[model samples]
Target: MKRIPKSLLKKLENRKEIGTFRTLKTKTALVDFSSNDYLGLARLDAISVRAKQILTDLGHSANGSTGSRLLTGHHPLFKKVEQQIATYHEAETALVFNSGYDANIGLFSALPQRNDLVFYDAFVHASIRDGLRLSRAKSYSFRHNDFEDLARKIEKLTSASSVWVVTEAVFSMDGDSPDWKSLAAICNRFEVHLIIDEAHATGVLTQLTEIYKQTTIENHLTARVVTFGKALGCHGAAVLGNASLRDYLINFAGSFIYTTALPPAALATIAAAYEKLQDKIGLESLHQNIDIFNRSVVNLDLKQHFILSQSAVHCCIAPGNEHVKMLSMQFEKSGFDVRPILSPTVAARKERLRFCLHAFNTENEIESALKLLATLL
Candidate 1:
């Protein structure tokens, strides 16, 4: 009964005043345009059925992972799935974590010891930043996707005992990518290790995000983090690297060491998703939708308002939080499911409507949404 803490109340008041207060809501019947299910696998009943089949065939019927992997939860399926992940992604070994957040937190917190220097992109995912915050290493942020800025920072401290470079393959909010080859070359020149989160580019398992599409970036880079929540339409994330790195995480990464392991269904779902990735059924349809959406944006003359991106995420700057939320309401009324990314999630002026493209989205749907958006603008 202590008046609910004045400081906490003040922060809540400030959020409401700025239109940044958040609330949970149930799913809607509006057209799909805001989910991370880029490949539409989440809607495929076959995947769910297959997941169950994989689990049963493996002779496991447990609903929970019993305990932490290092203790009692390290199931036999973990080894099998990890091997498949390594072969599919061409990594020497792979370590699966409960989620992307856990993977990054464990990797960053454990790998970079005290006195090491860490440089991350300005727009890198929050998970990586949080991990660095929990580490003892000295860290700096370079300009977003700017190799020159990163180079300057590296030059200032090239003599550090160890240096790590962190970035994302496809930025979650902006939907743009950095030049991996360029970043790799710079890291190599400065004797630094490179880490990339491929959360937004999962599913297809292509080299599309890399400048050299024909070859794998695993050897040119140090580590890669891939997740299933986005394009793969599943759960769980894995850090792909060499065998020694996996050993290191198993031995030292606290997040990996002290956490309860993912259940068998999650691992089975992961295996099923990768199988679908290999068959390439959903990839083509998803890529087609992305192409259609990209073309429709240009054709509708909404290019000026949109962020330049080749990924499934498209952002249209709407300036004010109030204005953006109003625009989102308009979109919902028009049968589109676009959502407003208000301040504090992104910077204040960067508030905008985010449209998430999916393979299930039709060309007409894409064009119609853009046409309506054009008229509103």
Candidate 2:
């Protein structure tokens, strides 16, 4: 077997020294407070049944997408699902990608050209940052969720061929959201294109369609990246924009063009998930759990430790990697599945316990977890 380079070994050693080394663990039977299945659709048997039915209806029994979408892999379900997603999201068009990461990479890398300027929130997802790294555009980061800072930075940029602003509807780590109205207003005032990653917001933010319908937000909003993996409890993602953006991506987005298309079954599952969204029972239950969790945090006097959020994701800061990891272990021992967000993933003192609320999480479970967390703290 070949040995890894000393540089790589040193990096691993550094992670261990800082108590930030990571390892994968199999799913356990602990009470759920960690997975991204916000609407509980991932484990909903009905979705599976519906997805199978969809595949049968479409006569798509193939096990794989043999080629990229532009090649032989553009299956019939792609068009149907894309149209469904666009209609659901109130977008002019929607173009599907293999995953959220691919969607972001494709959009950011392909849209911004040389002399184009991109101003993104400082704490936007790593995928977006990676995409920006591939772009020829000059990029700058504004303070997270700070519209004033974003405006100030844009004002400093006196000249550019084109300007773009990027942010997320809901930040994954902090579980906080940007003020969409304020952010959109800033983009409109500057006459810049606006892009929002709705990976953590899809299905979870029930008001999204109505929010997009507002004329003020609709005008300068260039694109939105929505994922099926989180709230939808499925795979794949889509870029929502006008037909021209879809056409441009189909032609120039390397991530979308080069990657093999998603399998027929995955598309079927996504369609099934979208169908489930219309029922509203799961969504209602999920929001109720979120409310319960929020109330529990306050009741247990743990609100100060938590980030303010109305989303399914809620993070409680525990500082050091060792400290946060210890708290996570304690929660696991108590039969809850809360996980720690370590440094490097976040900043050193901002390490936290990420609690993901779901529709299936019972009221008792929510209260008990917070009470345990409070005692542990």
Candidate 3:
């Protein structure tokens, strides 16, 4: 390796001073609460088997994609999977990308033109922010989940250029969601294009059973991004939109154009995962766990410590980096896999312990975990 750079050393020193230094650790075999395998599909051998079987049935056994999809890697399976995803999400078309990061980078960096305006939530994923940083458009952040703030920002822009807006269906860190219907209505009234990253909602919110239980926001979006890595427990993501938008991405998105395509196994696994999403066992059990978790938090009087959310992700605010890390260590020592969300990743005062509920987690596990939390408080 080359000689260490002093500037890089100083940056690491600063991170340590602020208690924001990050390091990798291997996975541990504890009662789960940290991993994003919300439906526990990552542990399912059948899904892998099904993926292989599908590849065999489709006459594909390539261990690697030979090149970028635009070159030699545009397998026939891509068309089928994209169409299947489009229909499932009720979108007119869908285009697959290597990952959620790639999809977001491709969309934001390529879609927003020089004269256009791009507005995003302050707490949107880092990938989106990085994409916006690369964009030529004028961009601004609205207060998190505050539609009024978004409205005020939109009203201040006095340009004739097109406006593009983006937010997450289920925010990754906070586990809270924007009022999709209201946001969509606002975008529709303003005639601005809207995009949603459904990374955390792909399997969990499939049918949209809530106040408007029978309706989904599928038609409300100009484009939607879905990743199979979270609840779906696979790898890869897709951009959902009209055929023209798909064509535009294919043409201009350098991230999509230059990168080698996802191999047949990954594509097959995503397809199998989507098929598994339709099954009642994993997804239904996951929801039931969420419900059980909600009741447990209330019964244990730990609700106030937690951010109100109905999603698989629930956050309990810990206020300081040291304190939250200590708490997370306690949970790990007690056989729970809960992890701390440190500052710099979140607001400094809003560091939290993120509990990810899953289908494989027993009701007893949920009850015990919250009970342990109550005692700590």
TM-score of each: 0.95, 0.98, 0.96
Task: List, residue by residue over 52-86, the lDDT tens digit for candidate 1.
Answer: 99988988658899999999899889999999998
Best by lDDT: 2
Estimate every model's Cα lDDT from 0 to 1. 0.86, 0.92, 0.87
Instruction: Give the Cα error of residue 50 in candidate 3, in Å.
Output: 0.7
Shift of residue 294 alpha carbon in model 3, Å: 0.9
Poorest stretch of ten by lDDT in candidate 2: 209-218
**Candidate order (lDDT):** 2, 3, 1
Candidate 1 residue 321 C-alpha distance from true site, Å:
1.2
lDDT measured at residue 288 in model 1 versus the true structure, 0 to 100: 87
Error of 1 at 4 (Å): 4.8
| Order by TM-score, highest first | 2, 3, 1
Candidate 3 lDDT by residue in tens digits, 3-75: 6799999999999998889999899999999999999999999999999999999985689988999999998
- C-alpha lDDT (0 to 100) for residue 46 of candidate 3: 90
Model 2 clash pairs? none
Summarize candidate 2's per-residue lDDT along 200-314 as a digit string, tens digits. 9999997876786663777778899999999899999999999999999999999999989999999999999999987774888999998999998998999899999999999
Model 3's number of clashes is: 0
